[model samples]
Target: MSKLAVGLMSGTSLDGIDAALVSIDEDKKMTLIDFETLPIDHEMKAKLKDAMDIGASSNELLCSLNFELGYLFSQAVKLVCEKSHTKLSQLDFIASHGQTIFHIPDGKFKSTMQLGEPAVIAYETGVPVVSNFRSMDMAAGGQGAPLVPYFDYVNYLSDETICLLNIGGISNVTIIPKNASIDDLVAFDTGPGNMIINGLMEAFYDLPYDKDGQIAALGQVNLELLEELLSDEYIHRSPPKSTGREKYGGFFVEDLIKKSKLPKEDLIATLTKFTALAIVCNIKAFGVSKIIANGGGVYNKTLMKYISESFDGQVEIGEYPDAKEAMAFALLGYETLHKRTSNVPSATGARKHVIQGSITYPS
Candidate 1:
């Protein structure tokens, strides 16, 4: 019998929650039974973005969001269950990529926080929940950011060389060779995906996102600004490196804006193009035969079209058209439930392949 698993993901965009109900067999084959993205309203989005770098003045505010987001996550899970016509008790576990507040990969503050409390999800859903997937990797001297490679390998295990690129708030690529060995895999953040693009929309346009990338497509890409963005050392950095809104944040965009001195629309267009270029550069660096794009960024038509042009058929746009990250997390949750190691030591630079995440049983 196939096991039913729920995977909940809140991306770097803080746009909303993506919940997927996946049925998996012993051999790791997956069938997506149900999937949905519940958009967080303007208030939640504002609160989350504000809390990213700035220190919060109120403990009550932070604590409230912690529980509220948990409820929000549970509701998302409930909605997916209803749509799939599956009950909570029938499911095995929930794998949650919790909301990330801060990701400090280096120094004394070496922990990344994803804070939709798993205990709260367990209490609300009455299902054993597995979450906090990143910290363990960080403890083991890994980036603790790109957790999708395990799932990427499981679904797209191939004989030829391939790269799985996930474009969320940050863009990360995972490399797989002809004969898959754990050590052969390479993955890292290419650069900004939807983070800069969406940040601009919210800052100037007062919108949450660029809706199919229409706003960006209408404007012209400023080559000067694009070149300036590409000049960052992060773009040229070698593999096993990961970045987030921490580096490519509002401040970074403001610098681009100052240098460009152009209309807001033109600035957005430039940043969008910059995102596409960073992705293409990474794909070329990997030298893989096929590049498979996935995540929220794939929904942006303009981004996809530019990516298609940038690669010029050298790399295909998307391997999975819909919610590959969420689907992959579902597979990760399945692996975690079965007591298997779901992390790639090479990808995260972890010393060993230890099982990630802590399980919260319904009590």
Candidate 2:
């Protein structure tokens, strides 16, 4: 039997809430039924940014954003259903990645917080909700991130080694070697994806992003700046890792803005190379045969150019770039509903593989 489900994802980019309606067969095969991204307004993004600054916002404000985002997530759910002429009653479950406000994956009191209350989603949609996907892994002494590896492994397991790279707010890669089992998976964050680049773009040109890498094409990459950035320890850090806005947020870019004297375009170009190099540096050790790229960064020609240059012809974009994460969450939700473990122990450095996500049911 094939069951219908919805996956909701709101990335660090503060771009929007992505909703994917997916159908999962009894055999665990998935088909994306309909997908949509409902843009978050600037006001909401500003509030999210404020809340992200740990302890900056009042507890009440943080609580409000959670419910507000849940409402927005539910709206996205409803939008996708309407697009596909489906009904809320027809959904088996809704899996939400929620909005990651703060994450401290290492240290004595390791913690991660993804807002957008699942209870609100259940209340509004009258459906089962699977959320807090990272907690269980964290409890098992894992970083509780880069959870997409399970999705990559199930979908693209192949005879030859291949890398599935997603460049969203943060960039990450999942490598599945030849004839791999779940234990053979290798994945980690490759440092900044579009975060630093997009932050610079928004700060300089008042644009959300440099569309198609047009601005960067006109400028030169400052080698000095690139080299200075290459020294970032996180990018070169070994696997069983993950990162987010805490390391590459607006403040990170603001510090750069205060220090750099290069022209805006040149700085953007240099940072784009930095993003590409970070990814390349991390993946080179694996010797994968191919890289299947996805997420928002795939549309940036200059970023792609740098990545493609190193891999030669080994780089290619995956299907439905924007929808992949949401689709993955839908599958994760499916697995959780079936009491299956979806987090890869190797990828997360978990003490053991555990079925992730907390389930919420409608009253």
Candidate 3:
């Protein structure tokens, strides 16, 4: 029998909360029942941005936001269930990725933090909650990121070289070559995704994002700036690595604006191209036969055009583009619920496979 569960993901892009109600069987097949992109109030958005900046945020603020986000997450949980006309009793569990505050995936101090207290969610909803999905892999000496590779491998592994790429606030790829084993997986972040472009949009025009490549379509890529941007060392890093808002957020955008001083349209165009090429740089050597892409970035036609023009492999968007990450988290939680180890050791640089997540019971 398939288990019914809800998965929630609030990515680095700060777009909104993605809630997915999905059904998963023991075989790892997922069917989305319903999904919603719940809006985060402007005040909450500003607070989330403040939380991302450790220097500007206080412990009190982080404390408040954690519980506040837990409340918001519970609301989202109810909304998803209600939207699908399914009761809370029908769900086996709630798995939330939570809003990532900061991710330090390197050095002896390697750690990652995500808010939305599981206790609060469980108590509020009267349902069990499983969260903090990255810590176990980190404890096992892994990067604690690019967790989606496990989801991709289970679903897309075959005798074909395929790349499952997700372009969220950051972009990462999972390359499963022909007849690959668990040790053969390759996955890592490809630097900025919608993060930089979204940052530029907000900085220059006070817009949340460039909807559907409209702004980029009107501008031309600045070759000089694009080349300069591509030289960043992260783009040169090997697989089993990951990056987050710290690398591409506020300061990075400010520096780019200062560096190129290009018009807003040109900046968007250049950044979009930068994202496309950075992804191409890493995946070209994999000899990938096809790329199945998801996340907010795939909707940008101009970005897609840039990537399609530069690559030789076939490119396709995922069927459940919007809900893919949410459903993936749901599946990850399902594994933990089963006491199964789901993190891909090769992809995450973990010493070994380990089950991840902290389970909390309702009050």
lDDT of the structure predicted as candidate 2: 0.92
Q: Candidate 1, residue 30: CA error in Å? A: 0.9
Task: Report the candidate with higher lDDT, 2 versus 3.
Answer: 2
Error of 1 at 238 (Å): 1.1
Q: State the lDDT of candidate 1 residue by residue for 268-333, as single tens digits.
A: 888888898898888686557777888888888888788878874455556454567777777877
Model 2 agreement with the true structure over 84-169: per-residue lDDT tens digits: 99989999999999999999989997799999899999999999999999999999999998899999998999898899999999
Angstrom error of the Cα, residue 343, model 1: value is 1.0
TM-score of each: 0.94, 0.98, 0.98
Distance from true location, Cα of 90 in model 2, Å:
1.0
> What digit string (tens of lDDT, one per residue) describes model 3 on residues 51-98?
998788899999999999999999999998889999999889999999
Give the range where candidate 1 is weakest over 10 consecutive residues by summed lDDT.
Answer: 312-321
Q: What are the per-model C-alpha RMSD values against the true structure?
A: 1.8, 0.9, 1.0
Full-model lDDT, candidate 1:
0.81
lDDT per model vs. reference: 0.81, 0.92, 0.91
Error of 2 at 297 (Å): 0.5
Question: Model 2: clashing residue pairs?
Answer: none
| Backbone N/Cα/C clashes per model | 0, 0, 0
**Residue-level error in angstroms, candidate 1, position 36:** 1.1
